[model samples]
Target: MPLHLPHLRSVINSDGAAIFDAEQGTLTTLNATGAMLWRGIEQGHSKEQLLQSLADATQLPEEQLRLDIEEFLEQLTAQHLITSE
Candidate 1:
């Protein structure tokens, strides 16, 4: 599945990233890990690629990274920050 962010603006800094939803007027902050995942999605990475990258960066198992990424994607979808394409 492809992920899409609609009417949202994201800013990445040294610490992490900030996301603003213009349509809903909501603001969200992401830690380094979250920012990495968000940027991966924004760049049109496949799920497998994302999992591999995250696992490499965190030194975690692929299964664990998969679960975490799934949960994060769910939250973004729930908050209307992202949609499936």
Candidate 2:
């Protein structure tokens, strides 16, 4: 499944995350890793690719990264930030 959103836009910054809505006047920030992973995701990487990238980039386990990526993607879906098909 592809997790994509129709109503939200995200931009990465030095701090972490910056999710803003002009109409809603909402700006949300995520943690350092969240921002990095979100930025990685924005780069159009696949789930498996994300796991590999995170594993290599962070020197973490691919299995753990995969699981966390799943949870993160689910969170994005729950927040209506992503749509899966």
Candidate 3:
């Protein structure tokens, strides 16, 4: 699935990322891991690519990484930060 980001402004830093939803007037904060994932999303990475990237960055199992990414994507969807197409 491709992710669609709408009306979101973000600042990614070394420590984490801060995302602002101008349409919703809400702010969301993310940790370092989330910052990496957000960068991938902005770069138009596929789910598989994201999993591979995480696998490359961490010593975790691919299955676990998949689940984690799914959960994170779901949370982003729930918060109206992203939509899957």
Best by TM-score: 3
Error of model 1, residue 5, in angstroms? 2.1
lDDT of 3 by residue, 3-56 (tens): 747688999998989999999999999999998898899889999998999899
Model 1 global lDDT (CA atoms, 0 to 1): 0.85
Residues 2-57, model 2: lDDT tens digits: 45444457777777787764545666677877787777666666777777767877
Instruction: Sort by TM-score, best first.
Output: 3, 1, 2
Model 2: ten consecutive residues of lowest lDDT:
1-10
Candidate 2 residue runs with Cα over 4 Å from true position: 21-26
How high a TM-score does candidate 3 get? 0.94
Query: Candidate 2 clashing pairs?
Result: none
Which digits, one per residue and each the tens of the lDDT, describe model 1 over residues 9-50?
999866888999999899999998888888888898988888
Residue 59, candidate 3: how far off, in angstroms?
1.7
How high is each candidate's TM-score? 0.92, 0.76, 0.94
lDDT of each: 0.85, 0.71, 0.89
Q: How many clashes (backbone N, Cα, C below 3 Å) per candidate?
A: 0, 0, 0
lDDT of 2: 0.71
